[model samples]
Target chain A: MDVVVDNLGVFGRGLLVSIQISAATFVLAGLLGVLLTVCRISPVLPLRLAATGYVELVRSLPLLVLLTLFVFGLPEIGLIGPLLWTAVAAMSLYWATFFSETLRAGVRGVPLGQIEAARAIGCTFGQVLTQVVLPQAVRTSIQPLASLLIAVILNSSLAAAVGVTQELTGQTQLLDQRYAQPLVTFGAAAACYVALAFVIGRSAGILDRRLAVQR
Target chain B: MTVTTEAPVQRRPLTVRLGSIGQQDAALFDVPGPQAQRRIAIATALSSLALLALVALAVRQFAINGQLEWDKWQLFTQWPVLRYLAIGLLATLQVTVVSGALALPLGALLALARLSRSPLLNRPAALYIEVLRAIPLLLLIYAFLLGLPTTGLRIPLFWQLIIPIVLTNSAVLAEIFRSAVKALPQGQTEAALAVGMGYWQTMRLVVLPQAIRMAAPALVSQVIRLLKDSTLGYVVSYLELLYSAKVLGEFNHTIIQSYVVVAVVFVIANLTLAAVAGQVERRFVGRAHRT
Candidate 1:
């Protein structure tokens, strides 16, 4: 307990950084995912194939590899950036592929009649997508999207590998190295992650319930 | 009131305009007009050129760094580098296989406990699953790797990686098995009981076998996840594939090249497993449909 109190500054900073990364990655990846989903599921053959190719190629490799490339390989091509942005980019690129798939699933969950009704009512493709399709798609996709965000939080731990020292796992490493109290420090760090996961699950559940009630 | 209100809505057929059954066009839009076609063609050409430029840049960088040299890659075929990577691969395989083997039985027990009538068993099982699922695998590994030695356990390094993987994965597998069991029609369990088989007997002979079969694809995916998770071993100074690649990179001063090779190996291994799992899934689903 004393150890935890003394190290609060370090661990708290780490947790804050982890949360920031998760939030940033969540928003960026979600937008990219929606774009990719539209491309993958669009009528344009080339766009669909291109989106498919990108998702498959990126998803096949581990996040670690992508992080390595972003950290080491990006600078070689003059796309130099800070470690934080590069980590976020790598994560967003990896996660967007998954988000697109989940969104696709949600789109599939929408009833065919809903789309047909929208179209018959003289909605254009874009109108139907934005007004009729996307709302229902997002609602249905909430659970999976919640899971994906949780995954983002977990994967952000990998950002520590590339010298993102402000994050939870990174702080754990720092503290562990200085104090050699892996059990106490890492335990506290794990507790932070577990607590965050619980919060995510509860919020997602609450949202799911609210939506259910509305329906 | 809410339950009654939801009943009718639940009965609606959920078939949306999913992509066409065969050769799914993931693209959701309709046929393009002539103008739209030209725009698409332009977009495609531009995107292709952009992709080509990126590849070209990477190639040029590799050339500049002297990583493209034939002699550099000879490291892969040589005695020491090849042996190191091979040993790392073997280490990863060992942990994946051993941990997976142990987790299965433990997971099965956990599933059974959760499904059992006793509140005591169900309560702990639920907590275990939720808690383990919440914590990241890396954190779990870190705690055990760094924490346990202080407690005077002093176990061998082999058990260190194995213990965390097994604990976390077993919890996941438990949930999978529980869901699989729940998915088995309730009538099946009742029918087995109607024949006077004991609870354990029914689970072992009737429910479990069917549930395991139902969950095999998901189980295989979990195994693939474990294979990926094993790479976290590098953090603990375990000579796994990623760590081995880092070592070779440092030795050869070709970190990017070394990492690329490692990534290729991981991709091939994981992709093969996924392909095999897909085949098994298709065959099983096909049989289920036919019967």
Candidate 2:
């Protein structure tokens, strides 16, 4: 308890980093997710094949393996450098694969006739996509998107293994080493995570209310 | 292309003007003209180039690293012997089956609970669900490592890891089911009640089966989620397939290849779920039609 009090500042700072990364990745992955979803549903066979392959490739790969490869393996062949960007790249790639599929499903969720009507009204592919398809997809996807955002928040903990600094889990390991308070330090770390989880849950509630009003 | 050949300056199908030249000149079936064919050829070439990059990356990684010798994919069967291989696979299958079994009825009950008029029950149900939804299964699994053993539960290690997951999954599926149930017209239930049935009997004979059918896709998706989240058992020493794959990755030093293999396996697994969902949907629709 005393150790937790002294290191509360560090833990709090760590919590903020976790939140910031999660928010950034949520935006990055969400936009990329939409693009990838479009690619997945493209009229071109190659795009379809590549999208299926991409989804399969990323989905099957163990996230930890992805993390380690980005952190350690990338610099070996001179593809990239440094840990933070590496972490972001890996996380973005990983989340994009899943998020894109989710968005595709949401896009598919929209009625086909609506898209045809928009096209009939002289809407280009881009216009039909942005105006008719995406708005409907976004509205339908708010709940699941919120769920994925929470996933991004939790997955940020995986960043700890590669030393993205003492986020909640990283701080727990460090505090544990310093004072051997595995139970207390980890518990406190867990509390910080729970609090972060609450913010996400609350924001989802806000989204629900806003969406309800809009509807 | 309602081909009404009145005199037009540039008599092209509107779709052809959308740059779908290939479709326009394929004689509606066979050999396209040269220009349209060239456009298609270019598109195909660009496609090959794109795919070539990924294939080259995988080949180059294996070549540059010279780590192909490290992967022992055969160990899954050859080394594990007959007993542990079944143990390994069954260890994975049993947890998924049991948690799914637990999740279905429990999720239904939570769905029912949330719909109750009592604020006392509904509020806590909502809170429990929201918290569980927000916290990733990893942290919950971590907490469960410390949390479950104290119960002195005589169950095996699989169930030890399963409880927290079941709890989390039940929250999610319950919400999906509840919303599905709510989506049905209020008239259905009222129509049943008008014929003089109590809530439970009507729910049993009229409401629930319909709700379950309506929510089938979301429910099956959650089941697939259970399969993925079940992979989290590694954190708590449950030694699911991902953990096994990780062991191979670290031992062999060919991390990408290992991940590639495991990912292929996941695709097969989820595709199997998708197939099952499709089959069940067809069966249910058939049944509904017969009724």
Q: Best-fitting candidate, measured by TM-score?
A: 1
lDDT of candidate 2 over B1-291, digit per residue (tens): 598878767678864554442221111122346875777678767877888898898778756755444434444345543344345446666678889999888888888888776899788888777666665565565555554444443556777678878998999998998888899899999999999998778878888888888898888877876776666656655767656655666775545555555555666777777788889888987897798
Query: Which of the CAPRI classes, incorrect, acceptable, medium or high, describes model 1?
Result: acceptable
In candidate 2, how many Å is residue A112 off? 4.4
TM-score of chain A of each: 0.94, 0.89
Query: For model 1, how does the per-residue alpha-carbon lDDT over A3-111 read when each residue is reduced to its tens digit?
Result: 7789899889999999999999999999999899877766545566678878877777778777876787666545678889999999999899998889888988878
Q: Residue-wise lDDT of candidate 2 within A8-112, one digit each (tens)?
A: 888888888788777777778777776776555544446656766677767755565577667756654456665776787788888998798678767777777
Docking class of 2: acceptable
What residue pairs are clashing in model 1? A41-B26, A41-B27, A41-B28, A42-B27, A42-B28
Expressed as tens digits, the lDDT of each residue in B1-291 for candidate 1 is 445544454443432322222125323345678998898778778766876788798788778766688887777888878888989888988888899999988998998888999999999998888888777777777778777877788877778878988999999999999999999999998999999999999999999878988998898888877777787776777788888887788777767778888888888877887898899889987886677
In terms of lDDT, model 1 sits at: 0.82
Q: Please give the TM-score that candidate 1 achieves against the real structure.
A: 0.88
Chain B alone vs. reference chain B, TM-score for every model: 0.83, 0.77
